[model samples]
Target: MNTENDNDEKSMTTGKAQRGPLRGMNPIVTLGSAALTLAAMALAITLPEVSLAWLTSLREALSPILATYYVALVGFFLVFVVWLGMGRYKNVRLGPDDEPPEFATFPWIAMLFAAGTGVGLLFWSIAEPITHFGGNPFSEEAGTPSAAIKSLSLSFFHWGLNGWAIFSVVGLSLAYFSFRRGLPLTIRSALYPLMGDRINGPIGHAVDIFAVVATVFGIATTLGLGASQMNTGLDWLFGIGVTSTTQLVIIAVVTVIATGSVVTGVNRGVRRLSEFNLGLSMVLLLVFLVAGPTVVLCAMLVQATGDYLDSLLAMSFWTGVSTDYQWQFDWTVFYWGWWISWAPFVGMFIARVSKGRTIREFVFGVLLVPSLITFVWIALLGGTALYMELTGTGTILEAVREDVAVALYQTIGTLPMPSEAIALTGGVATLLIAVYFITSADSGTLVITTIMAHGDPEPPRLQRVLWGLGVGALTAVLLVAGGVQVLQDAVITAGLPFSAVMLAMVVGMVRALRDERFAPVPGQKHRLAKEIWTGRDEVS
Candidate 1:
């Protein structure tokens, strides 16, 4: 009977393999995703101003809904992920109980930090705090001590638990369903509990397609931001003109490097780059801490963390319903939307590297560790800048307001270092940003190809290169068309529907966990009970 059941399962698997769409690819997903990507690119190129105008209009039209949904959804994710990590299901393993983790702790955490946030932290760590200090919708005064504190707290809030929660839930669902249930490692697998065998049907195809589109646009947005910042760094350091043409050239060069990394595979290429990123980030953080107001920065870190913790609930649910719409729309809503958009890509990459870990371990590692690192980074970088502004020693706020991309360089200039040291620091920073750009593009390439290859971890090298170049190209197009803001708006638009899919994923994961079929076998307790019962029966 057992043999027959095994044979039946094999037969079903073989049948699906034989009938799968487009030989190796899911036809619906491949075709649909390609069509949408191409259409978006064409729109951006042919009608640049019109396309941007429409995106702006859409944002304006959906401002209220976007604000409310993002606030509620991210807040719910934060609670749900924490509950999963700490509740009864904490012991559940993403794979078989006997399987050990694939990577060691340091590498795992390093990869998560590098791939999850990439260069965004480097770009915004100073700018965001300074911008918020200048004037935030939540605050009544500008450039005051209270505003400065609020700035750090709000910056931490944006980059902290809420963002990681988005990544955690998605990664948890994908890893659990794929590794434990022996399903394909794709976005559609998260729906298996609800769809069952129909996960191989049109519904499954749609889910994967949505993930592909979101991943592409999300990655493109990051690439666009990185290019702009890189351009700014070049301008500040070497007097290079920050033009669209120069930025496009930078994108092309980096894309080639990323393609090379993708060809080397994850273990050699992605892992090494991630480790390098971690090391360089540490050096930058250390320098900032040592050179700046170290004592004040430490105090600010403690106070800001406390403030963030105390106000987490209020800030999480604050939709700005009756307050300043533009402020909320620009900052909070935009951040939530951006994080959600990047969830599929970052979440999928994390799941791929996170096999053989327990649910609780994965959740905490993804949520807590990186988030704390982010807070410290913001404190060291942003806190130092805020202190400078308050003391009237630096004018970073003016630079940030004028061109946010150059905020990091401007802040570094204000440090009490010599001109030569400042120049060297700027050079190192540029190098770090470039490598981070390559890391993001390559990892994104791997994830996109895996989806396109129906969740094959080692997809074709050609496909990887294609997707890498495609991401770079899309970034260039958006940069020329409407610059970084357009890219931002585009990602938010893509993220709205994907957010709903993520909610469904949460429901499916919970439902699947409730089913006893997936639970661990009863071991020591059952054996002890049996031994006692047998002794009593024999005595009787």
Candidate 2:
């Protein structure tokens, strides 16, 4: 009796001790560090000779590795498409009580879109059309009908279905299984289907760590670009010099705003920011409609929509494996690798807010809605720039090659309400960029803490803050040395390791499902407990 009593006492004490490290930490550190890291990296880009060379070499060395990652992503997506379509696997859920989703469907989708794809969408909206108009990078004559149309179509193709598909499959699968199957609601659980027991071992730790690092740099790149451009907008509108100090100031300001939101917790900081960004986006879009060549832009959008539908598949999967190797390398492979690099963070984000959703529903929503919005954005804003460039209305191309931010400003200037338009556009751009980065960074910090602490949701604030500062310091160093482009290259490098990890996650998802369905053994306690809490299954 004494032995049993002592054992019970020891167990209780152990449990209390384990919980001690995770409670009551400051929130500011959790949020500020992420923003700071990105700023540092952006500043680093200013040292073109040293930082650029390092970034380039890092990217080049990782090429073969990234290519393999893309291939694996493609394979994973294809497998899910086949399995789900054929009804080989049923939808799974974790957690009981049918907890409400984190955000409304539209806003949730918008968050994912804005968070992962914002950089490309904004960058290419004006830049791509001009780049394509100059002719296929491989073809002769800048605007040859076949080549030009194909290039635009291909650009849409790259940003369209295939890009989103990779994220959609992994995210939706994980969400469904986690919510339905009583799995821990984290990325590691996504691998449960494949890794089984080993998922709790060294390999699993490595996968999750890779995901954390990838997410840090991936979001950092976006923040660096957006913050730098916001600085340019301030310069154009108010005569502020585009100095490193000014850029750092902008980074500091935005980081504080984001940190405040993050500390407020998810329901307040994250959701409110997402909603605010959406409203701001609408205003910016409205300005584009009212200020720009509304009629011509509309017509171009209609035309592009038609063309996009016609060529999406051919352009997306067009291995072009045989054609102009450089074209494939520069365009197709580059996009594939880019998307792969971004998958883990985006995938994790999707899983976070996507509780209480079905496999089919999550997949379709993530894949289709965001991609469609991107298609329209490019067709509208990018199409307008295309018209301006083609018709000699203004020199959008010269502006872009010279300076990308100026190119956007010049395009906005051509519209009717120039000042108001630029203000609205810049404001929205800054807010969206900042909010998304915050969402990515803080959420990432939170998620990383959870992973490191064995999937605890309310992780230690100290740990969260520590990770946040780490990200910020990394960003600061990179920015101080190289600048935003260098950060971009660093992101590409960071993504390489995570690509393989994401693939393992796919395999884990598959295995977990198979095990639950076929094995005679009872489910694990944690998994079963999650299901009961989330209301996925009835308590027997």
Candidate 3:
């Protein structure tokens, strides 16, 4: 199935052409999601402090129990993905058997990496590891050599393989149902096997509505967070004020740029920005690695990767009952919830770009490749900070503790470059953050608009502009009242229900995969390998 623009979308699914602003949209789901979004914005605007307090209290109360569920569920996702990718289901295509991928391999990966990580990797890469190193179950002591290694391992546990597996499951389920089974590419379509025709009625409507609402909130929260980071980056580099007004300005500027990208659709604007950010990210990472203790970072990567793999299961299953329970609620649980909430937005975007590929190739490319690259990034950047901290050569730990936003710029300043070169590198890092923010907003806009249009791959440009402004305004208003952080906590707490939705999706995907009429036999090892490698399964 070829992707379409909103103009083309009108005639493809509909028997006759339509016109006007709401053309090519599902009115009920669209209006319902819009209403909820507006209500959230009102809550932020009117009772900012009360909203903050309630959301905080709710998160603290629920995350303890929810963290355990998230842990168990995410661990299972990784295992399931591994089995599906390497076993009999390996050769199953996401679309028709003869269809080729929509985007080339490099561009495909670039977009995936951009949408999945974005400002997250930069915001957390150094800051998260240092915080864990300061104190965690794996590394209880503050600055011991052992503490440093295990601390990096904990970072890997959160940002590595398991997280990508979550995205893989969501995308696979949606892609399989929508492309192969001829269902609409929305949350409801993936549940067809379990829900049957009910998915076409209220049940389906509710599923799609909930996904749209959750995704809208999640995107707003991310934009708010990214705007905050950009505010800090400006102050760190050029001494621009880091006030709320500055953040509001940042959001406004980004929203405009993102709106343009969304209107242009994925291939032209989104693809180009993702590719640029990916390259700039690599360049910055290389500079950091070379400028600071190259041999030490490499050794740490090797050792920390080994440690991470060896204790993966123990860490994955740990609910912190025996260890630091509060830490579990604070860090790992928070990450899982955030990832689950984001699955709808990121998964749909990935599915749109990943139209034609085998389950095996998709799993390997989607789950493993980004994970490995992020692991290296975390190791080098965080590893460099840890080395300096342990050696007592840098004061970055002080900045990290006091203000995490400036920790990255602080790391850049401490690099062994001259003052002029240091300033140049810091500018580049700041530029990277802004680009990532743009890509994220653009991708999120595309995803939300697609859902609003009832899974039309290319949503109308008008719908995209509407959702894009809605999210930007929501973030800007919250930033004004200083409610962005509170709203983020609230939305992450809201992710609890979406976690259940994801579990249901897993069940539906399994049933669908098992129903595949012609899968290679597992006992025929040679045939299975050939089928997987050549993208042609042997029909029984």
Candidate 4:
């Protein structure tokens, strides 16, 4: 039976793994991404007013779209929570296994989780609170007690369960259907129950292309932010100017380091990077707790957690009263759309790395654990920054508003070691930033390659390199032109289609699961082939 199953898996692998139009096309995709990035940058520099105007126009167009979609997102998450519970309780397995493990059964899942989330979290841990301090457009009034509470609450809302819910649903749906049913792992596969074979053609191509573009921009944005932060650290520590030139050089150096990792592939490069990041992060957290204002920070954390719990529901569903429209439009709607746009790349990467895990495990692990860590961060780092600012220990928030990276540096200087500690922290943060960016970029490249190759994992190295360089070039262009806001505006716009795509995915998963005869039988050659094609075989 085992021999037969092995042959069956071989048969399925041969039948399904073939190059599609997107396979071996990374160079073209890279060049395309680079061109748009350069163009965006050029407009920002050569025609700043026009660039800003275009951004405004896009925002206006996006407002109505997000308003309509925000309601859908609420409904969408509720549906996801239901299905996630059902999938978990039922012990549903997508491909070959009768029962998947409660947690990620693969070692690489750790690498994926760490690499995908670490950099973004590090960047936002300090920066987002500062952004919030500027204003919570949703608050009853500017700079009120209510405003500060709302600001922190909304930040949690953005980074919490609902946000992860979007990612988990799309990711699990794709993995479940693909692995369980021998469908290709693409956006079109997510809609196969609806579209049938039509998904294998132009429509599928369009979905894949949209995902590719979004992933490219997402990675570029991270690279730029990370570089900018590193530049600020250098300027603060060594009196170097944090100019765009400095940012570009930082990016290039980081890219070189990342390229070496990409060459080693996931096991060596990605895994080591993730472990290093997590360890360094814990060290930083410990350092802050011991060396900074320990008591004040702890108190703020407890207060913030209590407040976040109290306001969680209101913040998540608040679409801004129609009468007050400003808060709804600026904060709630914009963030919803932004999360929607980021969902695809992040979701896809998660799904790819999450094989051998059950739905419930995936949901809680992805949704709950990340949120807990985020709250901790907000309580510690964010809480510390706030303490320093409020007590007049130093102008932390003011410095942040002026420049976020410098604010972090200045705040750190108030601690015991001063220069040595601050420099070391900055260096570690810079290293963490580079690892996360590369992890995200490399994972994206792997996913795109799989989508193009009809779901093959081992894509050509040349294709991977093309994606790496493409992401680098795009980041350089966007940095040079200082078009971060424009890119952000574009992200908001692109997110709407993905929201619809996720909706389609949920419907498809339900249909596929209910069609009982489609279920696989163990030790059967025919079933084994289906399992392999769908990436369900336990061996993989």
Please tell me which predicted candidate would have the highest TM-score against the true structure.
1
TM-score for each candidate, following the candidate numbering:
0.93, 0.80, 0.92, 0.84
| Tens digits of lDDT, candidate 2, 1-540 | 665346333422221224345343212222333344455455564554766777687677755544445545564575565455336343433233345555678778767775557655665666666676775643567754444454456567778777777776656655655555544445565665455546545565566556666667765666666666767777766788777787777666656555555556556666666666666666667767766778876776666667877865445445444554445555566666667666766776677777765455566677777777776677666666666666677787778777776656667766656577567676666555556556656655555555454444565666766666555556556665677666656766666676666567666555445544422112322233323232433211
Q: lDDT per residue, candidate 4, 1-540, as tens digits?
A: 686457435423432423653434433333444465567656766886776687778787767656656745754685566566555233455455654443333344455456446555666676676567657655556444445545566667766777777777777777775665555565566877777557655666566666666666666666776777777777776788978888878777777666666666665666677666666667778878887778877766666677777876666656545555555666567556656666666776676666656556667767777677677766677666665655567676777777766656666766666677777876765666666766666665566555544555565666666666756777777666544565556666656666767777877776665643333333222233433233344322
Question: What are the lDDT scores of the predictions, listed in order?
Answer: 0.85, 0.59, 0.81, 0.63
Clash numbers, per candidate: 0, 43, 0, 1
Global lDDT of model 3: 0.81
- In model 2, state the lDDT of residue 382: 68
Which of candidates 2 and 4 is the stronger one according to TM-score?
Answer: 4
Off by over 4 Å in 3: 1-20, 481-484, 520-540
Best by lDDT: 1
lDDT score of residue 83 within candidate 3: 90
**In candidate 1, which residue pairs clash?**
none
- Model 4 accuracy (lDDT, Cα): 0.63
- lDDT per residue, candidate 1, 197-265, as tens digits? 677778777888888898899889889989999999999899988898889999999999999998888
Residue by residue across 1-540, what tens digits does model 3's lDDT show? 543334234323432115666788777777778887788779878988877777788877876787688899999999988998998888777776767788899999999999998888888889888888788876657778888899899999999888888888888888887776655677877886687657657766677778877777677777777887788888977888788889888999999998999899898999999999889999998898889899999999999999999999998888988765678977888788778778898888888888888888789999988988899999988998888889888888888888777768877877888999888888888899889989988999898878767777788888899888888998787666554556557567757777788889988888767666577332232212323321334210
Q: Native-vs-model 2 lDDT?
A: 0.59
